[model samples]
Target chain A: MPGEHPQTLTRSTVAVRSASAPAAPDAETLHEIHRQERASVTGAPVTAPLLPAERALLRSVEHAVLDERRLLTATELSALAALPDSAVMALASLAHQVRLTWCGPAVEVEGILSAKTGGCPEDCHFCSQSSRFDTTVKATPFLDTDEVLEAARQTAALGASEFCIVLAIRGPDERTLARILELVPLVHAETGLNVAVSAGILTKDQARRLAEGGVHRYNHNLETARSFFSEVVTTHSFQERVDTCQLVREEGMELCCGALLGMGESDEQRIELLSELQDLDPTEVPVNFLNPRPGTPLGDRAPVGAWEAVRWIALFRLALPGVILRYAGGREITLRDLQAIGMTAGINALIVGNYLTTLGRSSADDLQMLDDLRMPVAALTVAF
Target chain B: MTQLPAADSAPAFCTGCGQSSASCPGCGRDFDPPRYCSACGRWMGVTVTPSGWTARCKEHGEQHSA
Candidate 1:
């Protein structure tokens, strides 16, 4: 088990396993969505029966996503979010159907290596890698070629088709770019894994160079909705991250943009992110719940509950039916034993081994989960 | 990790610095105590919280974060 970086920070089945797996969360496990007043986007009470109006809303959204193969608007997503906790299971079932219809059952497994650990210049408040924080993380230089190759080989052994070289920096400079370009091919040659990079923001030329260097995908998380972004990290604007994502796509590399949830954002704000993602159109959306790193700005915040996490996973899938909805970091502590529920809740791909700074569930356990669910692990090749 | 390190088993290197010395300035950040024993790679039991943290390798006793 990967202990949290102390910074830090699957699936399976084709058919529905349990309709009410997430069931209604009891008071002890009430979702953070209920703790705040934001769920009032709908006039219906939590105890309100699914009025004809609300049912029609869900059915309309379902028809658009499942029948028309279209994306949901922000208002539609809000209706889903405002659903009584009892409707979460039904929402999940609909999301599961959407995943099966749009993305199919083959799960993509990936392994990530923090090639350069810690000492990040930018202060993304949720991260422990920032040098600005008083975190206990030990900073290390880039791993040697041999070490990088070894990690790639380890990734390959885990049946992962994708391997990401993650570096903690604002962006890659000349030396860092050279090292990454050099390593991308060697990793591909050694492991036959699709190479991905998450080196923060990028310039237009840099994005072009990486794409030319056999980098198939680039990861740069939007972290949260633009409305709540400045509340967390002041080092950089959300626009910069979006620009890098746009640059990656413009350079012909697949963009892997994502969001980090549970950072005190509202349900409407989360819907806003989903809505923006509709315009961004990333090939993959890695859903990361906040694990709450100690010594960071978000350290004291409560982690997103497991059931709530599943609800959003389904929502992500429903909102973006075509993208690879990956179960990313912070899941171990966030989901614990209920991890399998996510598989049925519209999660189509996952990071198999360790994460950037956090240890994940054993690769064996994750693979076994796929096997148990009868979902085969397959590599994905999506268009830009 | 799949197995627990035996008591008196060797301490494994830090996942952070890749060294056995947990005292290294670069090692032991957000991790609880230690999931794997320092001298060995056996999975340990670690519980972490706001006030304090503990990692026990079964064989190597226990240590908190530096």
Candidate 2:
């Protein structure tokens, strides 16, 4: 965390301890410092299609930190993350540094189970589960609570620090919510591992209950940029997702939000997506490349190149500086031979083994990837 | 302006070629192709006018005179 000069450190940090007052941005000089950041983007190397002015504007937003401009124009942000190969790598390296300085070398391992697979009502082109597509994936109802608990125990034995129970529906209904609530305490008592949930769009009351039920973090992916969201999902509005994230936060639980790259979204769209996630100030951001599952609307969509993925990771490090950038889904298929190289590109956390709908690389392979990077996962574990 | 929904209801249309075929016929977009024309090997959405192949890249949507 960048330390503010004592005089500049707003008294609000102390005030938060005494009462709940909004913290000022240190001082107005902080805003001026951010204003100057816009000039740096101009220094980006030349590329076809991208104007130097656009590059500069992107740099301004991509490099924006706490004391600087707090946000970027949607157009500028898209350009920053959408750079071709090497340039993207450079940006990713910077992003990694920012993430490291703020977070640390800690890599959190989590196990994810799609409690209810397939059968989604929303028409999100990226999802194979949506009935709108001919994905042909079977939809199952809620899993038995006992079955879910057993999976949690297995995850704990496998050395996973967290177990994330996910469902494919838009949101959990009363019955499903009740089922999850019933098992939360059992999983905690038996496995002793932190539990998280991605039960879909949540309300304030539901979010509060989940938190009380020992759901440490609530994952609700923004999926893509607001501008591009409608093109990806029609049944749900972008603001609805944002509101759900806000609800999770207001309940005092950690907010986990991330985006899926390579859905034919423009680089500007990717940047805008990250910028929006930054605004919400999530505790963790899982960066995933589009894997293009067959039968889904985006099945034919090409995956983002390995180097491009690396660059996005680096850019994330620079922009957020302090947020957790977990390299989630699509690592094996997207990064290929360069899987280990991702660590140096500024990735700190990783999702080991299997993902929700797809099988991941073997846990041994992941352990080797970490060992090859010579970056030890920090032992100071975080539950949320 | 209203943001377009991320989900495109239209069946997968080859972005490279204007053909509304279900998938790219793997025309010129092979592993390698002519440098002068990015979409030389790929499906082309626009017609080959008197000028040559006139198509827009899926990402930039810029008119490319190949």
Return the top candidate by lDDT: 1
- Cα lDDT of model 2 by residue, A296-383, tens digit: 7787878888877777777666655566678788887799888876776667677765666555666677777777766675422332
* lDDT (0 to 1) per candidate: 0.76, 0.65
TM-score per candidate: 0.78, 0.69
Query: Residue A56 lDDT in model 2?
Result: 37
Candidate 1 C-alpha RMSD relative to the actual structure: 11.3
Q: Report the C-alpha displacement of residue A54, candidate 1, in angstroms.
A: 4.7
Off by over 4 Å in 1: A1-54, B1-66
True contacts kept of 2: 0.00
Q: At residue A216, what lDDT does model 2 achieve?
A: 79
Highest-DockQ candidate: 1
Report model 1's TM-score to 2 decimal places: 0.78
DockQ, model 2, C-alpha based: 0.02
The candidate 2 chain A region of ten consecutive residues with least summed lDDT is: A46-55
